[model samples]
Target: MFDWLYVLMKKLVENVFGLSLDTGIGDSVHFFFYDSVKIIILLGFMIFTISYIRSYFSPEKTKEYISKFNGISKNVMASFLGIVTPFCSCSSVPLFIGFVEGGIPLGVTFSFLITSPIVNEAAFAILWASFGWKIAVLYVVMGVVLGVVGGIIIDKRKLEKYVEEYVYEMQMNRPDIEELTFKDRINFAKSNTLEIIGRVWKYVLVGIAIGAAIHGWAPEAALTKYAGPGNPLAVLAATIIAVPLYSNALGTIPIAEALLMKGVGLGTAMAFMMATTALSFPEMVLLRKVIKPKLIANFVAITAIGIVFIGYMFNGIAHLVI
Candidate 1:
C-alpha cells in the first residue's frame, strides 16, 4: 500500500511540473505518469465546472447583501455559502476586500475566506460521490465549525485592530451597503469567478504536483511511525509537517488520497493538508501586503489551532465509532 501511494505521488509530481527525480522505478513511472495526466485533466474539468457555475448561477446583488452581514450569523452564513461558492485565493481577496471596504466584520469575512477554499463544490461532490452522504455531511459541518470558531477566535484576540493601517482606515459602517441590482449582481459574480480561477490556476497545478508525489511515493512506515494510533503528539506533529507545503482549494485531493492510502490518520493528514495548503505561505505573504504582522500571526495561530483540534476531533470520533 505504501509503495502504491509512493508511486502515485511521485508520478504526479513528475508529470505536472516536468520534474524528473528518480522514484527508483524508472520504467513503471512512465505508466503512472500517463494516468496522472488523465487525473489532472479530469480535475481541471471539475474545478472549472464550479468556477463557471458561480458565474452563471449566482447573482451579484445577493452576494453584495450577504457580504455585508459582517457578524457571527454572517460568518456561519458565509461558511455555508462557501460550501457551494467556487473561489480560489486571488479571486477571494477582492471579494474579501470589497466586504472589508464596505464595512463587513473581519471575523465574518474570515469565515467566508477559510471555508470557500476548503469546501468547494468539487470537494463536496468528490467526497459525497466517493465516500457517501454521512462522510460528506460531516465534511461540510466540520468545515463550517472550523471557519466559525476560527473567526470568533481571531475576533476575540482584537486582531481586527491589527489589519494594515490602510485596511483599518478603509473600514466603514455605511447604511447603504445593500444588495445590488440583478444585472449588476450577475455581472459581479461572473467577473469575480473568472478572476479567481485565473489567478489560482497556477497554485492548483503546483498543489497537484506535490499531492501527486506524495501519492506516488510516501512511505507507509514513516506515516505509521510519525502519526499512528496512540501517538499523543500526532496533532502537533501533523501541523508541523504541513506548514511548509502549500496548496489551495482543489489542489488537496491527490495528496489526501495518497496519505490516507498509507495509513495516516484522517485527522492528522487533514490538519497538515489544510494548514499547508488552505492557509499557505504565499497567501500569508499576500495578506501581509495588506495586514499587519500581528494580524497575520493571529490568523495563523487561530487556524493552526483549529486544524489541530479538527485532527484530534475526527480521530477520536473515528476510533470511538468505527
Candidate 2:
C-alpha cells in the first residue's frame, strides 16, 4: 500500500514540478511528501476514533472502574487506563490529587501517570505510520509493562508517606456534565483531531526535515561508530541524554527513525524516545508541585530502570526488526 502511494506521489511530483525522483534531493522530497501524507491521514483518523471512544469513559468512570481492582490487577488496569485516558501532564496533577483524595492507591495513580504520557496516541499513530504494526505493538506493550512494573514497585515501597500534604488537602470538584449525544461525540472528535493536528504538525515537519537531512546527507559510518549496539554505553547514553530535552513522542519518532537509518541501535533509539516522552525534567518539576522530592526521585528511578531494560532488550533482538 505504501509503495503504491509512494509511486503515485513520485509520478505526481514529476508531472507537476518536472522533478526526477532519481536524484538525492528529489528522493528526499519524495520521502517527505509520502511520509507526511501517510502520517497525517493516519493521525487524524486515529485521534478522532480514540476521542469518540473516550467520550464514553470520563475520568470519573475511569476512577470508578480502576478502584474495583486489587493487587497487581489494579496496577495493570491503571496502566492500560492511562494509555486510553485523555489528559496531559498539567491536567494529570489535579486528577492525581483527586485520585489520592478519593482513595485510589498512590501506586496505582502513579501507574496511570507513567503510562499516560509515555504511550500517547499521537506517538502511537506516528509509530504505526512510520514503522509498521509490529513496532507499534512493541512500543505499546513495553509502555504498559513499564507502567505496571513501576506502579507495583512503588506500591511495595509504601511511598504514600512521601506524598505531599497539599495533595491530600487539594480538592477536585466533580462537576455534573450533561451526557453527550451521538452528534456531540462526533463534533468533539472532530475538534480534538483538528486541535492535535494544529499543535503537532509543525513539530512533525521539523522532525521529518531533520530526518531527511540525515537520511540524504549524513555520514552513516560516523553515526554507527558511536551509537551502534557494539558500543557498550550507547543505549544508556541515549536514555540519559534524552531526559532533559523537551519533546513529544510524535515529534521524536521521526528523529528515531532517522537514527535507525543511520545505524543507531534500535534499543538506543527507543530508549531515547521513552526518556524524552516519559520523564523530562520539566515534567518532574511540574509533578513536584504535588509529590514530595522523595516520591519524585522514586518515580524517576523506577521509570528509568524500566526504560533502560526496554532499550537493552530491543538492542539485543534488533535483528528481528531492523
Highest-lDDT candidate: 2
- lDDT of every model, 2 decimals: 0.63, 0.85
Candidate 1's error at 259, in angstroms? Answer: 3.7
Q: After superposition, how far is residue 143 of candidate 1 from its true place, in Å?
A: 2.0
- Cα RMSD of all models vs. native, in order, equals 7.4, 1.8
**Model 1 CA deviation exceeding 4 Å by range:** 1-45, 56-63, 67-71, 121-137, 168-222, 248-255, 319-322
Q: For candidate 1, lDDT tens digit of each residue in 169-283?
A: 6654434545456676556655654565565556555544565565556777888777765576887887876777554544554455455656667677556656665577777
Best by TM-score: 2
- lDDT (10s digit) by residue, model 2, range 1-322: 4788888889977988678877767766776787788889889988999889877877788898999998899999998988878877668677888789889999899889999888877887888887787887898999999999999899999988888887777777778889999999999889999999999999898888877667667788999999988897998898888887656556777877877888988888889888888987777888888888999999999999899889999999889974
Candidate 2 Cα errors over 4 Å, as ranges: 13-22, 169-174
